[model samples]
Structure formats: C-alpha cells, structure tokens
Target: MAGRILVLNTGSSSIKYELVDVTTRDRPARGLVERIGEDMGRLTHRAGDGPPYTRERPVPGHGEGLEAMMEAFAAAGPELAPVAVGHRVVHGGTRFTEPVLVDDEVIAAIEELAPLAPLHNPVNLTGIEVARKAFPGVPQVAVFDTAFHRTLPPEAYTYAVPREWGVRRFGFHGTSCAYVSRRAAALLGRDLAELNLIVLHLGNGASATAIAGGRSIDTSMGMTPLEGLVMGTRSGDVDPALAGYLARVDGLDAQQVEHALTHRGGLLALTGTRDMREVRARDDDTACLALDIYTRRIRKYVGAYYALLGRVGAIVFTGGVGEHDAATRAASLARLERLGITVDPALNQMDTTGERAISPSSAEVPVLVIPTDEEWEIARQTHALIS
Candidate 1:
C-alpha cells in the first residue's frame, strides 16, 4: 500500500506511464511511448535528476511498446514493482460508476462498451492487457473518465431524443474535474460540498461542467466526448440535420460524418491546424475567426452553466490550454462583467505556474486557474480499490 502506483493512459498511438508515490506525491518515473505502431517509435523514460532514458526504434504494436517500457524501467532505475496499475479507461458507459478492479469480466464489460468510445476504449484495453502480462497478479484498476459525472442530475443528463435509443449525456473530463474542483475548494478554504463550481477543462478535448455542492448538475459533453465545446479537432455542437444533409448530397455515411466531426472539424477545419498555440500566434483573418469560434463556444457554455448553477462560487480552468493560455482565459470571459465575471487584466495576463485567482478581488465569482493532476487521481482511486 505504501509503494508506487503505475498509471497508464493509453491513446491510439501512445502510452503515457507514470510511477506515483501517493503518500509523498512524488513521481519516481514517468515517460511516454509515442507513435506505437509507427516504424519510428520513441520511448522516453525519466527517473531521478540526470537525463531521461530514451529509445527510438520500431514499436510494431502496443505489446512491443509495453515491453519497451518494462525494459526502460529495468535499465533506468527504481525497480518496476508497483502496488497497483491504474488504467485510464475513457468511456465506462453506465455500467461503471466507479473504479473497479480489472479482471476477465471487467475486460469483457469494457469491450462491450466499446461502441460508446470507439477511439479510446480499445486502446485502453490494450494497455490493460499488456500490463497484466507484464505484471501478473498485480491489481489493475480501471478509473473511468465518466465516473465523476455520475453525479449528474437526471434533468441535466437526459436528452430530448427517443428514450428507446438510450442516448444521454455522459460527460468526459470527470477525473480532471474531480481533482481540480477538490483542489479549488481547498484553495478557497471551504469544503467542496459547500461550493458551486463551473470547471472548464480545455485541452484536445474540452468540456464545461457545472458542479453544485460538489456534484455535477450539468455538463457540455453528451453521450460522447464529441458533443462538448469546440476542441482541438472535434466540432462541439453541430446541427443534427447537417449529417443527413451530407449523406444526401456528398454520399457520406454516418460513420464518415462522425469521423470528420471527430478528426477534421473545429480548429483544424477552421485554420488547417489543431494546435491552439499556433492558432493564437497568427493574426490572419482565418486564425482570428478560428479563435473567435473556439472562445465563443466556451463563452456560451459559461453563460449557460451559470444560469444552471444559479450562482457560481468559482470558475476553475484546468488542462493544457486552460492553465497556460492567458489570452484564451481572458478572451473567453471578456464581456461578462455584467454577470459579475471579470478577470483583472494585470493578474490574468501575468505568467504564473501555480494555482491562483485571475479575477478581481471585488468580482462576485472568482475565476481561478487550477492545474490538473489526473495521474494522482487515478492512482488514488486505484489505491482505494486495492488497499
């Protein structure tokens, strides 16, 4: 129970592993195996103070990638003995409302829910499978991204569509929201159960969640991650008729339309690039329009969630884009002064690498930037299940 917990976040083409000591909050070793199926794959492993152990070679599959990770741990340092392996499984659907110890039945259940998250669950399963072979008998826990939003009220999660289709909102970024929201409560010197929060997790996949008394009352994402705010590549809220229109005129199928919406929409469709930093750096008309579209989506969600929460104690921004992009933080909430949401220009624009408020002291709703630590959350949940 006192040892390290290995957290594995496997993507379509990458595996990000971190060895975390929950008690001391220290990451003894952390690294990535990127471009897994590519001919030129890379593995970068870090342990102590010196340079990270790096490897560049063909990683034919995730199995090979996991083998390489084991090799890195063996060669680098810190014996690869983890108390538990925490897997970040993207969509648990309605079946898994909490972290469950992984087993044959759990793996089958995760596979059954694959249709809900075709891009993520399959790869996440691969990580689990590979880890089981690597560390036999070690407990592996599946920490769901949808678990935190299980607190969503029926009204907030229910869709207006045919109930027979079994479609409704199941928000992502729940893990990040859980961590940041609790940290936000601590920063404010209040209990999480007493605070009303609107958490904006902005990264490749962005979402706005309204947390009332520490419970998710509403969130932007619905049924799938593709329904949230405009993300790096996903088009958040598209007209339902547009896909039908495309099918009729362009001979595109539903899967094709979904694929385009998932991989080629949003900033990529607007500006030919998915990186937000690149979009903000350029002052061209197209880039400016893309920025406007992105921030406008976020601003709309803020207003909508504000109305839902009735009163917000704090608006916490987390994830890569939320923590570092001061311009985005400012632009998203620019003209909301009437709603008691105003960011102090001096504080908002300053470059700081800590959790701090950017809103004016006199503002009714304080706006904060809290960095998310999902790895720690995963490890904690995994530890709770096993120990």
Candidate 2:
C-alpha cells in the first residue's frame, strides 16, 4: 500500500499510464501510447528529469499498446511493480459515487454503462481487462470522473426531459475539480466547507461546476460531456431542435449530428484548429470571432453559475487552457468588475508554474490558476481502496 499505484487512463486512441508513489506523491514513470489502431503510433516514456525514452511503431490495438507500455517500463528503469492499478472510468452513472475495487461484477457493471459513454467506456474496459491480465493478482480500483459530482442536488442534475429517458446532468471533470477545489481552499487559507466556488476546467474537454460547502451543487455538463463549455473539438451547447433542423435541412441523423458536434465542432469548427494557443496566435477575423464566441459562452456560464451560487468565494481555473493561457484568463472574466472579480494584469501575465492568485488581493473573488493533478488523485483513491 505504501509503495506505488499504476494509474491508467485509456482513451479511444491513447493509453496514458503513470507509476505513482502514493506516499511521496511523485510520479516515477509516466508515458502515453498514442494513435492506437493507426499505422503510425508513438510511445513516449519519462522517468525522473532525464529526456523521455520514445518509440515509434504501429500499435494496432490496446493490447499492443499495453505491450508497448510494458516494453517501455522494462527498457526504461523503475522496475514496474505496482501494489495496485487505478483506472480512470469516465462515466459511473448513478450507481457509483465513489471509487470501487474492480471485480467481475464491477467489470460487468462498467460494461453495462458503456452505452452512456460509447466512446470511452469500452476502451476504459479494455484497459481494465489488459491491466487485469498484465498484473494478475494486483488489486485494480476504478476511479470515476462522474463520482465527485454525485453530490449534485436534485434540481441541478434533474432534466425536464421524460424521466423514462433516464437522462440527466452527469458532470465530467470531477477528478480535476476535486483536486483543484481542495487546493483552492488551501491557497485561500479557508476551510473548503465554508467556500462557495465556481470551478472552470478548461482543457480540450471543458466544464464549469458550482461548488458550495465542498459539494457540487450545479454543473455545466448535462447527460453527456457535450453539454458543457466550448471545448477543443466538442460544441458546448446547441439548440435542442438542432438535430431535427439538420435532419430537415441537410438529411442528417441524430447520431450523425451528435458525432459532428462532438468531433468537428468547438474551436476546430470555428477556427479550423483545436489548439487554443494556435487560435490565439492568429490575428485573422475568423480567429478573433472564434475567441469571442468561446469566451462569451464561458462568461454566460460564469454568470449563470454565479446566480446559482449567489455568492462565490473564488473562481478557480484549472486544466490546460485555464492554467497556461493568461490572455484567456483575462478575456473570459473581462467586464466582471461589477461583481468585484478583477484581474491584476501584471500578476495574471506573470509566468509561474504553481498555484497562485491572478486577481488583485483586494478583489471580492480571488481568481486562481490551479494546475489540476488528476493522475495523482486517481492513485490516491486507488491506494485508499486497496489499503
């Protein structure tokens, strides 16, 4: 239990694995198997401060991806023995509110939930299966992204749709929110239970969550990840009649429309590039408009969540765009001075790789930039379950 936990986050085309020392809170080894099932695949492994050991080969399947991971561990150092294996299972639905030890029953339950997360759960299960095979006796724990938002109130998670449809808000990024919210409380020198927070997780996949007294009261994502803030490739929110309209005008099916929204929308649809930094670098009108649309959507959500929380102690930003893009940090919250959320321009632009406040010390709501540590959270949960 004191040794290490191997955390696996299996995506459709990538497998991210990390060897974490739970006691030290350090990652001894971490790497990714990217472009699985593609002709050109890459694996990059890093241990300590040295340059990453990388390999390029065709990884035809997740099994091959796991094999490449083992090769990387064996070829690189650290000896690759973990006390427990932690898997990042994206959707837990209503059944799982906390991390659980993986068993045949757990595996079957996860399989049953696959339709809710068609793109994620199967690959996640593939990772679990491979990990079970790779480390036969090691205890495997499933850490759910939806688990942290299980505290969402009935009004926040409930949808107006038919109850028979079984559709409701299932906020994503709970792991990141959990890590950053606790850090935000520490940074503010306040107990989390007393703070009302609006957490914006702005990575490739983004979400805005309102937390009160250390619990999720409301969130942006509803039913699926596509309902949230504008993301790298996924459109945040569309009119409820969009699918029917598309069908009438362009002869598209609901699934096809959903696929397009998930894959070809957001920044990519607006600017032809999914990377925010790339979009920010361009001076073209198209890029400018895309940025406006993106930030406007975010501002709208911030205002909506503000109304929900009534009083926000801090507006915490995490994930890639939230952590690194100072311009975005400034633009997203611009003109909110009436709400006492003012960014200190100099402080916001200052380059630092740690959690720090970007808003003026006297501001009503401290705007913080907290880099999320989801992998470590997964390892911690896994260790807790096995220990």
Candidate 3:
C-alpha cells in the first residue's frame, strides 16, 4: 500500500503491465509484451515523462515475458518494487464476485473455469503464477473481467440451454462497463441508481450490457465471449445449429468450429481484415458488408436492451472501436430516432480527446463516448486489497 500497485493483464499471447501510484493516481510506468512464444517478441516500456524503451527478443513463455518486463523497469527507470500485483483474470465462473487475493484455492477455481474461457484463463493463470514466483512477498489479487456482471439478474444471466450443461451467460467487459457506467452517471450529474444505462464495449471482443440501477440486468454475451456483437475476429452471434451443420458438411468438430467462431469469424470472415479501421477504409463490397454486419449487430442489441430497460437514460460507447470509430458509432445508432437517440455530425466526427457526450442537442438519451480505464480500475482494486 505504501508503494506502487502493478497491474498485469495477460492475454492469450500478450502481457500488458502498468505500474500506478494509487496515492497520486500517477502511472509511473507502463508497457506491453506482445507476440509471446514467438520468434520475435516485442516489449515497449515507458516511465513517467520519458521516451519509451523498446526491445525485440524471443520470449518463450509468460515467465520470460514477465522477466523481460522486470528488466525493462530496471533499465528504464522506476524502481520495480510493488506492494501488490493485480491480475486481470478473464473468468471467475460463479465463485468470485470481487477481487480476491490469490491462493491455491483461488488458483484452483480459476483453473476450473478455464473450460469457459479457453483463450484467456490459462494464460491469465500463467501470469498469476509467474508473478507470484517473481514477487513472492507481494500480495497478488485476481480481478475478474466477469466479476462485476455477477450482479446480473437471474433472468438476464440464465440461458435457455439444457439445464444439465451448466451453461449460462457470463458477460465479459464488466470492468470496462463498470468504470464507464460510473463515469457516465457522474458526467450526467445523476445517481447511478436512478439511471438506466446501455453500455456498449466494442473492443476486439465486443459486448452490450443493459445496466439497471448500477447492476447488469441483461447482456449480449452468453456462456462465452463469442455470443455477443460482432468483434475484431470473433463471431458474435450465429445459429446454434451451425456447428452441427458444419460437422455434417465439412467434417469440422465442435472444438474446430468453436475455434473458427472464436478466431476466424466476424470481420475477418466477412472481410479480409479484422480491424474496423481497415474495414472502414475499403470501398469494396466485402468491407461494406463487414461494416454492415458489425454495426447491424450493435443496432440489434441496442434495440433489444432498450426494450428490456424500458426507459434508458444514456447510451455509452467504450472500448477501442466504440471510442475511436466515429463512422461505426454513427451508423450503429442511426435508426434509433424513435428512441430519441441521435448523434451530432459535428461532434461525432470531431477528434475529441477524452470522455464527452456525442448526442444531438435535443436528444432525449445522452449518447456518451467514455474511454475505458480498466488498468486504472485494476490498480485501484489491487491497491485496496493490499491496504
């Protein structure tokens, strides 16, 4: 608590670390270790008010990646002693509702939930284990991406699946949604309990959650991150029978189909690229279709959640695509005039720097674009746990 809090977000093949001074809200250092287990791994480390230090070397595993991160801090600047380490673990299943100090039981629970998040949890566990080893005395807290959504009502979380499969909607982007929703309410000068919010988190992996009175009442994703709006590469929603159909026709197994849906579908399947910026730049029919599919899916969720919320006070956009892509934002909410949602062309197209509303002057619902701060939230939580 007396020192900095280091937050680690371990993705499938990347490690994102941030060292924050919780007392001052100052990030003394931050970096990313990308392309792990590859021939050439890259690390970009930066300390406060300094040029970033860059390195390209072979990082064979998450442990090596973390060691390189430590080296970066040693060589660059900021002393690498953290009082606590916060990890962004992707799945908590039904056990974790808040950040918990990692122990063997917590590790076992995370491992048990790996089947639900095959792409994230295992790698996240690797980071936790490695960090535990590297800083044996430091308190390491596991902050779940699904934890905030634990407040989801039964109706919203329950899937219409066979009860025996033990499957249900476990929404992602909860941390981002939590931070933005709070910020949106504060910006509007309204209490979160009195507001109905539609939160669209459109990063590489996208989701739409309907928050009623600061709690998730409904969300777009179900069971896995693959069941929501169109994302960078993952297919958001598809027919359940498609897997069986593919198996019958193309000899694809369930896992193979799941992999395709998780990695090869969505924008990549529709167009030649996964980035929305790339898709927006093309004038070809393929890119046009991809954009349509992406925005249309968002529109559908907006409509569905609007009906669910009955009276929505605000529509918030966060994450990479939501914050940056003006065209996608405009197109996604284009036909919601009846819902009193409209974006001003001037404001929407302008290159605004930080959190700001983009709705039309007379629009009933405030359409806001709040840049998410998940790392800050993770750091805060980690600091709180240690203190």
Candidate 4:
C-alpha cells in the first residue's frame, strides 16, 4: 500500500499520468501527452522540478502515447516502476461503486457502459488495455468518477421520464468530490459523517454536489456530464425539447444538436471564447453578460443545494476556477448574507492558495477553497485495492 502507483487519465486527445508515491502523498513524476493521433504532438515529463523533459513529433495513437511516456520516464529521472496502475474511467453507471481491478470482464463491463460516457469510457478503456500490455503482470484498477455518487438517494437519482429508457441522474466529478469533501472535513476539524457540504467543482467540466454525512445526496450533473454547470465547451441544462425543436426548424438532427451543445455552447457560444480567464480579461458587454450568466447559474444551484441540505456546515469550492478565481468565488455567492454565508473581501481576493476559508469569520456557513487532487485519490485507491 505504500508503494508507487501510476495514475492515468486518458482524454479523447490527451493522456495525463502521474507516478505517485502514496506513502508520502507526493508525486514522484507526472507528464502529459497532447494532440494524440494528430499530425504532430507534444509530450511533457516532469520529474524533479528542474525542467520538464519535452518531446514533439507525430504520435499516432494512445499506444504510441503510452510508449512516449515510458521513453520520457526513461530519459528523465525517477524510473517508472509502479505496483499498480490506476485509470480514471469516467462512468461506472450503477454497477461499480468503488475502484476495481481491471480484468477481461471488467473491460467488457466498461465497454458496455460506453453509451453512458461515449467520449470518456472508450479512451479510458484504451488506456487500460495499453497499460495491461505494457505492464504485463501489474494490476490495473479502474477508479470511476461516478463511483462516489452511487450514494445518491432514489428520489434524487430518479427522472420522471419513462422506465424503458433506463436513464437517470448519474453524476460525474464524484472522484474530485470524494477527495475534497473528506479534505474539507479534515480542514474543519470535524467528523466527515457529521458534516453537510456543497462542493462546487469548477473546471472545464464543472459540477455542484450536495454531500451529507460524506455521501453524495444530490449533484448538479444528471445522467451525463453535459447536464451540469455551464462548462468551458458544454452547455449545461438547456430546454429538454431543444433537440426536437432544432430538428423541426433547422433540419438539424438530434445528433447535430447534441454535438453543437456539447462543443459549441456555453462561454464559447456567448462570447466566442471558452476560457473564463479570457472573458474576465475583456471589459466588453459580451464578456460581462457571459460572466453574469455563468455566475447566476452557479448562484441558483447554491440556493437549490442549500435547500436540499437544509442547514449546511460549509460550501466548498474546488477545481481550477473555484480554487483560483476570487471574482468567481465572490460573484457566485453574492447577496447570500441572509443565509449567513458571506466571503470576506480581503480573504476572498488574497493571492494565497491551499485549503482556506474565504467566508467571513462570524459567518454561519463557511466558504472554503480546496484544490482537488483526483490523481492522488485514484492512486490511493489503486494502492489499497492492490494491497
């Protein structure tokens, strides 16, 4: 359980990996392979913080990407030898509530859940397959993003649609939620089972989850990652009839509408750019409106999740935007002083980092900024299961 674990998070066009020293809770080495299958690609390997070992060429596939990573590790320092390899498989549906060792059956099970996470599970399974071949006898574990949300109650997970569709709310970002919610309790010096929290994971893919007694009760995402908060390239929670309407008026099929909503919507649709930092930099009306819409959506969720939890101990902010964007942190929770939730202007705007309270000292509900580490959590789980 104390040995090193290699964590791989394979995206559609990228492969991110970390060689974690679980005993120390520190990463010995980490790297990323970007633009995979393209005419050209880039690989960055960071070992001891001297300078990242870099490579650029035409990487053909995920298998090639894995090969490049191994080469980078060999050329760089910290020889890559892991007791177990952990993969970030995005969807586990209702079948896998915890990390499991990848076997032939597990591969087939993950493949069967591909419709639930078409963009994620396929590539995740590819990573598992390649790693299994590369490592030979090493253990490969699939740590699901949906695993932590398996605790969602029936009322929260149920949709009123039809029984034949077999569709319901299956939240994403539960891995990040699992790590941060427990970290939040540790930061607050309270028992996790006694705390009620609202965790906002504001990354390119964002979600807001309500955790009571360390279990996910309700989450912003439903059925897919596309149903959560407005993400960088994803439009979250549009009219349910949008696809049908587009099909009628524009001659666009449901698939076209779905593709547009997933890739061409959100901040990109409004301001012509998906990055929040770019929008925040410009003072134009378009950017201002985009920010307003984004923050307002978050505010609404805060209110809704707050109601769901009745009385909350803390409202946690994690992920890239939540951890660094002070303006977002303030704007998202603005005018919530009535609920005894208020961020201190000084603390909120500080250039500091790490897990710290941004709420006013006397505020009833603490607003905290805790950076998430899904890789570490995955590595720990992998090590645990391997041991």
Candidate 5:
C-alpha cells in the first residue's frame, strides 16, 4: 500500500487508470483504454513528461482492455507491478460505507447493487475481477463513490414514500467531494469541522452536495444520478408522474421514459448538442436559453444548500466543467449580492489555475475552483485501508 497503487476507473466502454506512489502522491504511469468492444480501440500511456506511448487495436472487453494496459506499461517503460489495485465503484447503496478489500463476497455484493447503478457497478466489478486475475497476488480494493455520503442524516437521505418500497437518496460524485472538500479546508486555513461547504461537481454528470463538519449532510443526486442537476445528457428533476402519464398516453413504459431521460435529455434534448462549450459558443436564442436553464438550475441548488447549511464558508466548484467554465461560475452565482456572495468579475474570468478563490475580497462567502482528482482519492483510501 505504501508503494505504487494502480487506480482503475472502469467505465461502460473505457478503462481509465493511473499508478500513484502513495508516499509521494505522484503518478509514475497513467493511461486509458477507450472504445472497448468497438471495432477499434485506443490506449494512450504516459510514463513521464516525454511523449506518450499510444496504441490502436480492438479491445473486446475489460479483460482485453486491462491486458492492453499491461502491454502499454511493459512496452513504454514503468514495470506495471502495483502494491494494490484500487477500483472506482459507483454505488454502495448503504451496503458499503468504506473501502473494502475485494473478494468473492464483495464481488457478489457489487453485482447485487447493480440494480442501483446498472451502468457502473457491473463494469466496476469487471475491473476488480480482471485486476485480481491480472495481478494474481495483488490486493484489489473498491473505493465507492457513494461511501463518502454515508454520513447523510436520516432526514437528508430519507424519501417520503412507502416504507415497503425501500428507497432513499444515495449521492454520487462522493470521491471528488471527499478530495476537494479536504483541499478546500486546507486552502481556507481552517479545520474541516469548522467549515460548511457547498460543492458543485459539474461534469458530464453533475451534483451539488452540502458538506458540514467534513460530512455530507445533503446532496442533489437522489436514489440515482438522474435526479440531480441537469447533466450532459440527463434531464434532472423530472416530474415523478411522467412515466405513468407516458404509459397511459404514448404507450411507453417506465423503462422507455428512463432511457430517454438518461441518454437523450438535458442539453442534447434542448440544444442539439451536449457540450456546454458549443452552447456557450453560439449567441443564438436557442443556445442562450440552454445556458440560462443550465446555470439557473445551479443557482437554485446553491440557494437551497445555503438555506440548509445556514452559513456556507465557501462554494467549491470541481470537475471538468466546474473547474474550467468561468462563464458558468459567474452565471450560476449571478444576482446573489444580497447573500453576500459575489464573484470578482476580473478574478473569476482570469486565466489562472489551481485551487484559488474567485469571490470579491469583501464578499462574506468565497467561491473557489478546485479541480477534482478521484484517482488520487481512491489511491489514498486504498493505501489507508491496506496499511
């Protein structure tokens, strides 16, 4: 656990990996196997600062994808032996509250929870199974994205429905939240217990989490990732009765409605493109409305979380869109001066980098941009568990 820990984030069709030396927080090697099961797949491995070693081939499955990773490390330079292999499992569903060493029981549990995260847990298990086989004796650990949100109080996680149905909010993007919130406390020079934070993890999949005393008190994502903020392709916060309505009128079942909302809704359904940059690039009315809808949802969440926490020490933004989209950072918090939360236009729009505040110096609340690193968080957790 003290040595190199290989972090594998297995997606539906891609496997993202990075080798972290827990002692130094450095990635001696990193790579991705994308377009798996497709006619052609690509693996790009970076060992050092020099040019990356790239390969193009057919990666039929996760097993072949991992084998391709081994091939990359073997040919590119860094000997691919890891002290432990850490995996990113998307959902814990109250069954797992922390990182667990992978075993047959763990694998079965992950498989069982696939009903909660049909698209993620299965592939995550595949990575664990393949890594166990690939490394033979190396320890395999699963660091769930939902584990960090286990601290949610009963009220925060409970749903107002039939108790026999058995459902509650299980927030996602917890790995990112765990890392960036700690970094936020460090940047503010305050103990995490003393800070109340609202973390907006806006990426392809977005969520807003309220963290008090370094614990998740509430989150936007509910029983599934589809219930939160509008994402790249997901329509968040839809009417609960839509499924029944569609079934009655259009002869569409619940599955069809879910499929459309999960894959074809959001920006894609609104603006013909899922990319925020594309919507931001155009001045057309359609694009303008899309941006407004997106940013407006974020502002609503911020206001709600602020009311929930009563006092927010900082608003942290992380993930691909959150960290890079200056326009979003500004628009989301627009017209909130009454709340003593205001972004410094110059500072917010500046071409700066790394953990930094964008709020006006005199503002009561600070807005920050802290890029998330889930790979390192998994490696850190894995190291701690095995150490």
Candidate 6:
C-alpha cells in the first residue's frame, strides 16, 4: 500500500498501464501499447506533465507489450516497483464478486469462462500469466470488470432462454460504472444508498445499467457484451432467428455469424466507421443513420430503466463517447422532457474538463457527465486487497 500500484488493462490488441501512487491518488506515469500482434505497433508513454514518449515497433504478443511498458517506465521517470499488480479481467463469472488475489485455481476458473467471453477472457488470462512471471513474487490481484454487477438481483439477471444454456446477463463495464456512479453521488451531495441512478457507459463497447439503491438492478448488456447498446464493432441485439437464417441462406456457420456479430457488426456495420467522433464529423447519410441508431438505442434503455426504477435520481454518462460527446448526450436525452430529463444547451456544449451536471436547472432528474477512472479504481481495489 505504501508503494506504487501497477494497474494493467490488457485488451486483445493493446495494453494500457498506469503507475499510480495510491496514497496520493496520483498517476506518476501511464502509457499504451497499441496494435499488438501486428506490424507497425506503437507505444506512447507519458510521465508527470511532460510530452509523451513515442515508439513504433513490432509487438509480437502481450508478453512483448508488457516488456515495452516496463521499458517505457525505466527510460522515462518514476522507477516502477509496484506493491501489487492489478489486472482488469473481463469475465469473472459468479466465482469472483470482488477483487481477489490471483492463484492457479483462479486462473483456471477464468479460463473456464472463456466460452462466455471468447475474445476477452483468454487474452485477459494471457496478460495475467505473463505479468505473474514478469513480476515474480508481487501480489497479483484480478479486479474484474464484471465484479460490480455481481449484486444484480436474480430476476434482473436471468434471461428468457432455456436455463440449460447456463447463460445470464453478466454486465460489462462494471468498473467504469461503479467508479462513475459513486462519483455521481458524491458530486450530487447525496448518499448512494438513497439514490437511484441510470448509468450509461458509452465507448467502443457500450452498456446501460440501472443502479437501484447502489446495487445493479438491471443492465442492458446480457450474457455477453454483444447483447447491449450498439458498440464500435459488436452488434448489440438482433433477432434470435437471424443466426440460423444466415446459416441456411448464406451458408454461414454459427461461429461465422457470431464472429460478424462480435467483430464486423454495430456502428462499423451500419456505417463505415465506428468512432463517434468520426461519424459526427461526417455529414453524409450513412453517418447520420449510424448516429441515429446509436442514440435511439440509448434512449430506449433510458426509458426502460427509468420505468423500472420508478424514481430516478440521476442519469449518469461516462466512457469515451459519453464523457466527450455532448451532442450525443443532448440528442439521446432530448425527448425525455416528460421524464424530467433535460440538458441545458449551453452547459452541455461547454468544453468542460471534469465532472459536472448538464441538466437544466428545472429538470427533475439530474443528468451528469462523469469522466471514468478505471485505472484509479483498479489501483484502489488492489491496494485494499493487500491492506
């Protein structure tokens, strides 16, 4: 707890690392290794407040990505000797409800959940294995992205599908949602227990969750990340029969359809691009349609969860697009005036840098934009484990 905590958020093709001073709640250094397992990989490292250090080289795998991160810290400032290494493991299933120290058995459990999250869990375990070897005896903690939603009630999580499939809604982005929703309560000067919040996590992967009395009552993403709002590359929802129809008509297998839904679908499929900023910058018809699809999906969830909550204290927005894109926020909440949700145009349009309420003064439900700090949350949880 006295030393820095190294928080690692490893994706299939990237590694995001931060050296956080737990006591001060400050990040001394942070960097990203992007496009791993490909040619022309890039590493951008930043320390303190200086310019970022950049490198372009081939990163053959996640192991190399970790090595590059270490090299970045060594070459830059702030020697990296972490008290603990916190990894952001995607699918913890029902086994891990909170951050737990990783052991061989835990690693095996994560591997067992791979079928539930084919693209994420396997790669996540790879990061865990490589880090365990690289950092030797350091305490390694698995801070799950799904951990925060473990409080979800049975009715909310159970899917309508046959129970034999052993599938249920295991919400993603729990770390970001947990961090932002708690911060939302703090920002509003209210106790989280008394607050009913609808948290919208919009990024490459998006989800909406209803936090009733500070526990996840319901969420948009179910069973898999592919079940929620439109995402960057994943199709959020589709007709149940579409997969079988594609198999019969187009000679596509179940795996092929799943791959497209997981990889080539969503905003990328609707439009040529997936990033909201890119879509917003374009004035073409396709871009406009994609934006409509994205925001409409968000609006539906807001309305659905609002009904479920009966009384909403706040509608919180976080993640890449939610935190930065004001236009999307305004557009998504525009028609909810009857629900007491209205954003002040001037406040919403302002170039704000931190958390702030954008809802109109007379609005009943406060609409807030909170920047998410998953790395800080991971570091805090890891520190807690050791303490």
Error of 4 at 198 (Å): 0.4
- TM-score of every model versus the real structure: 0.96, 0.96, 0.97, 0.96, 0.96, 0.97
Candidate 2, clashing residue pairs? none
Candidate models: Cα lDDT each: 0.91, 0.91, 0.90, 0.91, 0.91, 0.90
Model 5 ranges off by over 4 Å? 35-40, 57-61
* lDDT (tens digit, per residue) of candidate 3 on 1-387: 577889999987889999988898789999999989889999999999799999999998888999999999999979988889999999998889899999999999999999899989999999999989989988999999998889888888887888998878889888888899999999999999999999999988899999999999888887788898988789988899999999999999999999999989889899867878888888998888788888999999999999999999999999989999999999999989988999998999888869998987688999999999899989888788778
Q: lDDT by residue for model 1 over 254-304, one digit each (tens)?
A: 999999998899889999988899998899999998998899999999999
lDDT for position 211 in model 6: 97
Please give the clash total of every predicted structure, in order: 0, 0, 0, 0, 0, 1
Q: Indicate the residue-level lDDT of 36 in model 4.
A: 96
Model 1 segments beyond 4 Å from truth?
A: 35-40, 58-61
lDDT of 6 by residue, 238-298 (tens): 8989999999999999999999999899988988777788889999999888888899999
Higher-TM-score candidate of 3 and 5: 3
Q: Lowest-scoring 10 consecutive residues by lDDT in candidate 4?
A: 20-29
* Residue pairs clashing, model 1: none
Worst 10 residues of 3 by lDDT: 272-281
lDDT measured at residue 152 in model 6 versus the true structure, 0 to 100: 86
TM-score of 3: 0.97
Model 2: lowest-lDDT 10 consecutive positions: 113-122
Q: All predictions: root-mean-square deviation over Cα?
A: 1.6, 1.5, 1.4, 1.6, 1.6, 1.2
Compare the candidates by TM-score and give the number of the best one.
6
After superposition, the stretches of candidate 2 with alpha carbons farther than 4 Å from their true spots are 35-39
